[model samples]
Target: MELTDLLAALVAADSVNPSLVPGGAGETEVAGVIDGWAREAGLESERLEETPGRPSVLVRARGTGGGRTLLLCGHIDTVNVEGMTDPHTPRIEGERLYGRGAYDMKGGVAAALIAARDASRLGLAGDVVVAAVADEEHASLGVQEALRNVSADAAVVTEPTELELAVAHKGFVWSEIEVTGRSAHGSRPHLGIDAILKMGAVLKELEQLDRSLADRTHPLLGRASVHASQIEGGVELSSYPAQCTLGLERRTLPGEAGPEIEAEIESLLERCRQADSEFQASHRTLLVREPFEIGQEQELVGLVAEAAAEVLPEPPKITGASYWADSAFIAAAGIPTVLFGPGGEGAHAVEEWVSLADTEAVARTLVALAARICA
Candidate 1:
């Protein structure tokens, strides 16, 4: 199938992440369609069910033996399309294909599927695996299951990178800090310890932390970062709230450890306590994904760069992605992984689209790279 048509079919299927939106349609239908497509292409295909109805499509072009494996991974599930108008309907205008997952990124998924099928037909020296996983918009349970089931020498996560070769990306740790205080009626200031007011001090400390992060930078990825994602406190206007919770995310560099993040939070809490003895707070790490980085000299990197130069009008611009991806998970498992994909805008926005030209170019590049490395 043509890359554009395949992407149209994919975008037509509903695959909103259930974790992000309750009662959301998931990857079950999409995975089934991909499986059938892979079978028609003569590739070995299967589904890995991580959650009850969330299945990941695994398609493989097996090697002749004694050769390496290249994994092309893309998420099947997209963020919720609540505000989108006809999000599942793919519309093509000139070189752009508009749809919810068109750029962020069922377009990349289609490219990978076609590339894997092409490699299989060529009978390459190494295997090429197209893994369309679920739950990437949420907890990434699908990629976790994929790691347990497959191994590869290297991987490319097709994650809407505007066709850049992203060798490094930030990983984030989710944390929650709860402030505790005594509740009392609005008239009784002395009787109530205001947790909401206490959180003000914590927020100030976080500002200092953010500045410190700004001073620390990586070559390709720029600086580490921290942000308060959510804050909730106070029950009613008539009373001082007993508790306030501040949700934070710390984006880590490649070598930063989880303990360092915990320590940073602890230090901030300690600073708050020093300023006000009445301040009471505690923090815990909710979740984490390790940052990914790889040297540009890796063989897989060279192959992709060479292929991209052949396929694209301009030489590939190598860089790092500010956002995290399943690439980190694959890189964590010791496989060299990079992010590469189609160009577009409006990820998680009301209107989304992908560049038809870039989508096809990425597929052709992957096909050429697979043939070069596997042969």
Candidate 2:
């Protein structure tokens, strides 16, 4: 199938991943479409359901027996549309195909499927698998489910990497801190405790955490990070809040996992709790995506580098992904993985778009890499 048709079919399906598209049901419609497409193309495919009505699809073309198992991963979700009402439809306007998941990334998914089709047609000699899973925009439960079925020698998580070879990526952890206090009337001078005031130290210490972590650098991922994403507390306008909650993110690297970092943050909170017992504080881990990296010198990276340099007149940029992808899961499964995809900038925005030329180019490159690696 042409890349345009694949993208149009995908974008038009409205598979807004519930995580990115808050309140969205799932990408079941899109999964249904892809399921049919893969089956018709003579590829083996299945839709694995994590929860009822929440399903993910796995499609694979039979391998040439010897070299390696290549798993291609992409999410079937897009962030919810804010102001742009009909961002779901793919509209080709002046060399750009504009849609929600076009770049973040139905485009990547299309490219991988097309490349797998190309491999089957051209008789490339290795296993080519496509995992178009759900919840990548949220907790990544779909990918976690997929790992239960298939294991690969290596993987290419198809996140937008500007057509570059992504050898490393920082991990992401979502956490929340709750601070409690005694609610008091607004008119009272010292009758009730203010939760926000109690958390003043927590916020201050959170800032210190971000700063201290930023100062240290990694050779590839550079600085780790913490972001204060959300805060909520109190009900009435005039009453002192009894409780306050802060949502936070911590960017991680090879040295840490979710539980390990959770312990560190809890330790910090423990200290704060001891200093001021009135502000009893506790934290819970909302999400933990372990940080991972496969060195540039690995076989998979070298295979793509060689093919890309040969295919493109200019060298493909060698870079690390700042955002996490299913690559981490593959790496965690002991597969050497990389992030490689087409060029596009406004991913996850209302103005998101990907060039048709880039889509075709990435498809051909994936085809090349499969051929070389399998050979």
Best by TM-score: 1
lDDT of 2 by residue, 300-334 (tens): 88888877776688768888888878888878888
Quality of model 2 by C-alpha lDDT: 0.83
Count of clashing residue pairs in every prediction:
1, 0
lDDT of 1 by residue, 1-375 (tens): 667788999999999998899998999989988998888888899899957999998899987876788899999899989788899999999999998999998999999999998888786789999989999999999899999999988799999999899999988999999999999999999999999999999998888889989988999999998999999999999999999999999999989988988998999999999999899999999998889988999988888999999999876889999888999889889988888999999899999999999998999999988888777
Which one is best on lDDT?
Answer: 1
Tell me model 1's lDDT, rounded to 2 decimals: 0.91
Segments in model 1 whose C-alpha atoms lie over 4 Å from true places: none
Candidate 2 has what TM-score? 0.91
